[model samples]
Each structure stands twice: as structure tokens, then as C-alpha cells.
Target: MGYYAKELEALLRAGRFRRPIMADPEKLDMASNDYLGLAYKRKLLRRAFERVAAYPWHAPKSSLFLGGYHPIHRDFEEALKEANGFAAATLFGSGFLANLGLIEALVRRGDTLFIDESYHASGMVATKLVRGEVVLFAHNDPRDLLEKLADHPTKGRRILAVEGVYSMEGDRLKREFFEIAEWFDMVMVVDEAHSNGVLGPNLLGVFDHYGITPAPRHIKMGTLGKAYGSYGAYVMGSEETIAFLNNRAKSQIYATAPSLLDVALAHEGFDYVAKKRKKLRKKIAKLQKCGVSCGYPEPEGLIVPVPMPGIEEAVACREALAREGFEVGAIRPPTVARPMLRVILRTPLEARHYRELFAHISEWRDGV
Candidate 1:
């Protein structure tokens, strides 16, 4: 505990925590997941705000499982499912809970859980909790999963787990991964937390872009916090799986449903993305021109992950950029392999901001 405290203090001294600042409406901000620049748009804000402002305050008097599931929840679920081509979707409070709930619904004690070695920590914990015999394949390496599957005990069942886009490093899922999932008849769970509103020509996620429909063997978990710029997550699957999760998953059954206002905002956010994804993609492309190394520079969507070596180097670069009136995000693991810097490229940050950021990087003292 002492050692952990000392390490946290080290991070604090470097300004890495850096106040996780709220967006200044007047400032040019890139620190948020508002990739489409929709979160701040007054038009959409007014629409959602109006709905929330009108919500009957008396609704909160009811218990979550009773009559507390608001009309907006159903509306958001329908719209989200329609937008993403899912047969059905169930909302959860956040990505971590969604991932955990999905796993618990799918895996049992006798099952074999094979996960991407670097998959999100939440998915890993979910798989572990059920005491499923676990096998891990190298990141994006489907052949390794196939080989492991050959020997794993089918006395139970198998689930293949991986992220659609690795959140930390900005890497993408290799197409071949789905083939392994298909071949093994393994339940494939794809967490599109980072990729949902960013991938494909339609922002329909990688699976939909590839023309693969997620079936019983395929599950999609998407978060509202990232590209959606809102506050929750949803799992997409067949009606049966959703029903099972709602009944048996501890995270879902125990937690109060999310706020009506949050669901309203989520609906507005997704609607905005559906209409303006092309514009967002173009802006992301222009940003790639200036940064020396942006993870997936041409980006498969709205996220631009800029990598900087050394923890101190990343920290200093972030502070320097922040002081310059730019709000770029600095990410150090437990998110990435080592420490890397990230910049969320909102549509508000035009080509000129990218230029300034690149210029700042050139002489920036990367404190090591």
C-alpha cells in the first residue's frame, strides 16, 4: 500500500492528474470524447435538455425495477439498436459494467474463456470470476487462439473475447479474427467501447462494416462515454441473451437504472453522430497530416492517439500543450502498454489547431 501511494504521488507531481478539466465553452477543447463536436451543439442540447427538464420528478419516487424504467430508456434502446443493426440492446450504467454483465451472462463455471492478452481489464475480471479455464492469445493473433482452442476442454464451452479497437494504442482488430470465432463456434464478444462511433464508413462498428451480423455467438458492448460523448453503455445481441443478462447478471440486477436525462443525452449524441460521421472522419484525416506519429494516423474514425515515449515525456508534453490553451488528453497506463499521450480530435479543433499542436511538439521538452 505504501509503495502504491508513493507511485500515485509521483503521477500527481507530474501534473498527469491535471484536474481532468471541465470544458470551457469558450475554449478550443480536444480532451473530451466529443469527436463529432455534437456534445456542445446548442440545437441538440436544447432538445435533450427540454426532455429532461420536463421529466416528471415524481418518477424518481419509484424503485428502479418497478416503474422507474423511463420511456426514454426504451426510446434510446430502439434508436441505438437501429443505428447499429443490432437485433436488440440493453443499457447498462457504463462500459465496465456492460462488459462484466455480458461475460457473466455468457460464461459458466465449466466454460473455457479465451481472451486477447491485452483486452480491457474489465473483460478479464469477468472471465476470471466464473472460474472458467482461461487461455490467452497474443493481441490480434487469431491463429494462436485457434491452436489453443484445439486442445481446450469442450466439456464446457468456449468464448473468444477481444476489443474492436484497443483503447490505449489505437490499433484495430485484424479481420482474420472473426474467422477464428466462426471456425471454433466460440461465442465472440467484441467490446466496441472505443470503436462504436468511430469505425466503418457508417460508424456501425467493425463487425457490421465487415457485413457480419452479430448472432448468439457474437456480442457487441458499446459505451456512451467515448465517441458517443454521453454517459452509459449497452450490449447488443439477440433478445434471449439480453433477457438472460437482465435476469442473472449481478451488475444489471443490482444497480439502479441510469438517469432519464443521461439517456436523453445519449439519444441525442448518437443521432448527431449518425448524421455527421463523414465530416468527423475528414477532420481526423487532416489532423494526421501534422502529428509525427498518431496511432492509426489515418484512423479507421474520430480518435487520434498520439504516442510519446517515457512517462515524464508524455506528462510534460500534455502540460505544455494545455498551457498553450489547448486541452489535449494525456494517458498513462493502466490504459496503454507503457505511457502514451492521447488527443481526442473534436470537430471543433480545425486544421489550424493540429498545426499548432505539431509545432508545439517539435521543441517541447519531453521530460524524462
Candidate 2:
């Protein structure tokens, strides 16, 4: 304890000390990543439970390589591949693990990984474990990416990573990124955690939204926790790429298979999204309108970030909203470059609630 005391004190002084608090179900949720509100739907839960109960093994007892790959997992993978127009798909314990496994397994020595600077931290951390060269381009700037590519040439494969709807800024990936990847012959990895089930005509994710036919080099990784409202993740790519990951990705080979219940629930979530996409899109558009009316830029997705002056002010604003029976995320340094209130415009929240939230945010921004 004494050895870590100084570091702890420093964090406290910076107003970045962290602790998890119990979620109050009674409060109106405006912070969590359950974009489609599938987490609160009892019908989905009931269906998932029924499905799980019918299976002989409700839990994965071993790694997927060791016979833990159940029919449920395979079915979900198949569904994902079909919906997203990928040749194959594989499941992972979570989005972080998927990203970690992908970067670690795909980028070998002599290879180069050109990633967006604003990509998720998990992918950033994975770079340290790989033997490849990494180059970061300006966030969402394709010109910077092209410049970096011109500056660095590699003998081996080139991989590009970007997010569909960045978590912090809530901005969609630029269309030019896909074109660049194709022109440069790079393997493009799109993290669709925030966009899947929330965007596109089919709500399959960014690929669907952009109407881009996935090439052999295109890879898509998406989480079930956000819009899907479950847990676990899936990666979709060409059949050969997925097979290579199965053989080389230690994270998937060493860890136990994902929970059967979660996968089943996510499958139900996929169906739910398909059935309700039209209504969900309308809800999202309404929230985006409200945000724009309140002086915020129109959100590319469901996340609406309200910037705060500083860390202390961000915390204070969160507490004030909590007192008013609203629960929102007060994001600070390390997670975001600046302090902000992350408001998730979840579909479960009514239009009136959004209006109220925007009003409060406008007041706070104006120092009313």
C-alpha cells in the first residue's frame, strides 16, 4: 500500500481517481452504452433464457479450440456473417479481446499498421505486443493517412484500423478511409462497437450504412454490449483470415469460449434490431435534432458529448444531473482528451426526456 500511495495521491490530485458505483435502476439512464435499450427488454431476456435452458451446456467449460465451441456460437457467427456480407465470422469474449487478438495475430514483423489516432485504447495497447511497425494518422483525416503511407513503406502486409462512430467524439469514420484502404491494398479493420445495431439500413453497421461490399481484406469487429445490449464480440472477415485468426490468435485459443447466454441474447438482439430498425432510426433522428437545437453538433450516432470546462466541473455537473434523477457519464482525462458529459441517447428514453436533458445541458453550457 505504501509503495502505491504516491501514485494514488497523484491521481487524486488530478481529479482522476476512479471507482465503480452501483447502478441505480430507478434513475433515468442516459450514460450507459445500451444504445437500443435491449438490455432492459424482458422479452429478449426471456427468449435468451429459454434458448439457454434447452441447451445441454449453459456455460462454455473450455476454450473454443478444445471443443467448447457450441452450436449456439456457430449459429450466431453464421448470422453475423450473413447479415454483414462477410465470408466468415468468429466470436471472442469481448470487444477488447477481439481487438487485442486481431492486432497481435495479424501484424507480424516487417508489417505496418496504420491506425487512426482516435482509435480505442484496447487496439492502441495491442500495438505494444506486436512486432510490426505502427503509424498513427490524424483522426478521421484521410490526407494525413495517405501522407503517412507515402512516408512509410513495408515489405509485408499493411493493415489499417479505424472505428465506425468513435466512442468519445461520436463521429462516424470518414468515407475516404474505405477508398484509401482499397487503393492502398491494405487490410482494413473497422471497430463497429458504437455503430452496429444503431446505423445502416439493416443496422448491420458502418459497412451497411455506406453500402460498401466487403472485400477479402476488409475486417469488421463489433461488440454485443452496446446497441445489441448483451456481452461478447464478433469479428467478420474473409474465410481465410478468420481461419488464420483461429490458428494464431492466442487470446481466443487460450481463453474460455464466451458465455452461451450472452451469445444467445445477442442473437435475439440482432433479430430485435432488424424488426425495430425503422422505429429506432426515427428515435435517433429525433435525439440528433434535439442535440442540434441545443447547440451541439448533430451526432453521427447515439452518443452526445457535452463538453465541460475541466475535470472538477465535469464531476460537479454529473452530480447535479444525478440529483435531478438523471444518470450520465462524466468522462475525464485518459479516456478523453478533455472532460465531458457523455450522454447516450438510448432508444428506451422517451422524447420528452431528451428534451429535458438537452435543456439542462444548454443551461449548464451557458452557465445559467
Candidate 3:
């Protein structure tokens, strides 16, 4: 216990302590996951919330297996399932819980789990709880994943996990990843937290980005928080897959279901995104013109990672930018493999905002 305490102290001393900050209306906000900016639109959000205003505050306080489950949840699940072409769908409290519950239930002691090296922290945590063989492949590299599969060559239950749109790097998955998983007869689990409302004709996710139909063997976990600007997540898969998780996924079975208001907001948010996608894309295109260039892969979504090279330099750049009234994401080790500025774009941002951001990055890069 003392050893862990000391380690935490060291992290704090090194400016790596994790702390939360309440959202400030006056701040030039850029550090949020509100890709679509619906959360910031008061009138829109209020109107959406009004649809469920009749529901009581403490309506959904019980776990799904208990009294928490509601007809609204079932209706939302069915709607999302039909829209996304899944055999069945189940909702959870959040993206983290969705990934934790689904992944833990799928990968057991006798199974093999292959995850992307750059997978989200929540998914990584879920992997730790699995009593199975866990292998990490190079980020977004299908060839390396193929090599790993060849090395393991498991005929038993196997899972290949990836993110549809990488949260930190903003990279998108290619069709090749799906092909590789299918070739090996492995279950493909895609966490589309960042990509859910940013991709597809109707924001259906990665399959829309790639212009392909969803494979039956694919298990998709998507969040309502990021682009959807709501407070829950959902897992879509075959009826059998969903049924198994409903019975076995500990997080979902034990955790309280989302409130009726939250579910209502998510349903409305989905419709909002679908209606405003074209306009949102225009805003994204404008924001993409901001900031300094990086060597990372081109973004397939709204996240724009501006590289700062090292921890000290990244911290300095973030601070300097903050002083200019822009609250950009100051990313560092542990959350990512290396230090870089995580700049998430929103549909409400203007060209002037990006121009200021670009100016700051130029100043930092020039060391002036």
C-alpha cells in the first residue's frame, strides 16, 4: 500500500496526477469529447430533454436484471438494432461499462484475446480482468495482426478487438482488419465509442465509413456520450451473443440501468446527429484546417492530434495554449504510448478558433 502511495505521489510531483474540472462556460473549450457539440447547444438539448420531462428523477435506480430494466430501454435497443442491422442490441450505463461487461463475458480462461496496442484504457482494463491469453498487436496494422494470429494459431474461442476510430490517434479501421478476423474465424469486437455518431450515412458507424455491410460475427460497442452527446452505450450483435452477455456480463447485470431521461436524450441525440451530419461534416472540415501538422495517420473523424514530441514539451505547449484561453487536451504517458496534444473538434467551432489554435502551435514549434 505504501509503495503504491509513493508511486502516486511521484506522479503528482511530475504533473501527471489525474483531476477533474467542471465545465466552464467562459472557457474557450477544446478538451471535450463532444464531437457533435450537441451538449453545448442549450436550446436543442433542452428541447430533447423535454420529451422525457414527465419521468421521475429516481426512475431507473435498479440493476437491469432487477427492476431497472424498462420498456424504453427495450424499444431503444430494438430501434438501434434495426438501424444498425444487428440481430439484437443491449444498452449499458456508459461506454466503459459496455466494453467491460461485453469483453469480460466473451473472453474466458480458455480463450485467446488479441487487442490493438492503441486500444482505449477502458478496454485495456477489461482485458486485465480476463483469465485468458492476451496478445497485443501493433496499432492498425493488419499484417502484424495476421502474424500474431499465425503464431497463436488457436482453434479454440478467440476474439480480435479494435477501435473503429482510435480515440487518441484518430485513425480509422480499414476493411482489411475485418477480412483478417474472418479468415481466422475469430470474433471481431469493435469499440466504436468515438466513431458512433461521426461515421456512416445515418451515423451508423464504421460500416458506413467503409461503405460495407456489417458482418454477422461482429460485436459492436458504441457510446452515446461522444458524438451522440448523451449518457449511455449499447452493444449490438447476434441474438445469441446479446442473450449470453445479458445473462453473463457482470457489469450490466449488477449496475443500475440509465435513467429514463438519459435513454430519451440518447434516442433524440441519435436523430439529431442523423439530421445534422452533413452540416456537422462541414464544421469538421473547417476545424481540420487548424493546428500544426503531425506525422500521425490522417484523421477519419473529428479528433485532431497535434504532436508535441515529449512530455515536457507537450505540457509546455498545452499551458501556453491555455494561457491564450484555449483549453486543449494535454495528453501524456499512461493514457497514450507517447505525448501529443489531443484536439477534439466540435460542430460549433468556427474558423477563427482554429486560426488562433494554429497560431499557438506555430509559436510553440518555432520555440518563440
TM-score of each: 0.87, 0.98, 0.92
TM-score ranking from best candidate downward: 2, 3, 1
**Worst ten-residue run, lDDT, model 1?**
55-64
In the range 278-348, model 1's lDDT, one tens digit per residue, is 98666656764645452234554455677677677877787787778877777776567667667665666
**Model 2 Cα displacement at 251 (Å)?**
1.2
The candidate scoring highest on lDDT is: 2
Q: Residues 1-368, candidate 2: write the lDDT tens digits.
A: 79899999999999999999668998899999998888989999999999999987799899998989998999999988997889999999999999999999999999999998989998998999999899999999999999999999999999999999999998999899999998989999999999998789888778999999999999999999988989999999999999999999888999999999999999999999988889888887787777665667878988888888999999988888888889999999999999999988888888678778878776776783
For residue 254, model 1's alpha carbon misses the true position, in angstroms, by 0.4
Once model 1 is optimally superposed onto the true structure by TM-score, how far is the C-alpha of residue 324 displaced, in angstroms? Answer: 1.8
- Model 3 agreement with the true structure over 1-368: per-residue lDDT tens digits: 77599989999777677777666676677889887777766665676567656555537779888888877788788888888888999999888898889888999778899999998888889998998889999999999988898898665688999999999988888779888878788888999888887777667779777776667688989998877777889999988899999998998998888777777777877777777878776666666655434333446777888877788888889878877778888888878777899877776777678667767787788984
Model 2 error, position 261 (Å) = 0.6
> lDDT for model 2, on a 0 to 1 scale?
0.91
Question: lDDT per prediction?
Answer: 0.74, 0.91, 0.81
Worst 10 contiguous positions by lDDT, candidate 2? 287-296
- Index of the highest-TM-score prediction: 2
Q: What stretches of model 2 exceed 4 Å from their correct place?
A: none
Q: On lDDT, who's better, 2 or 3?
A: 2
Model 1 pairs whose backbones collide: none
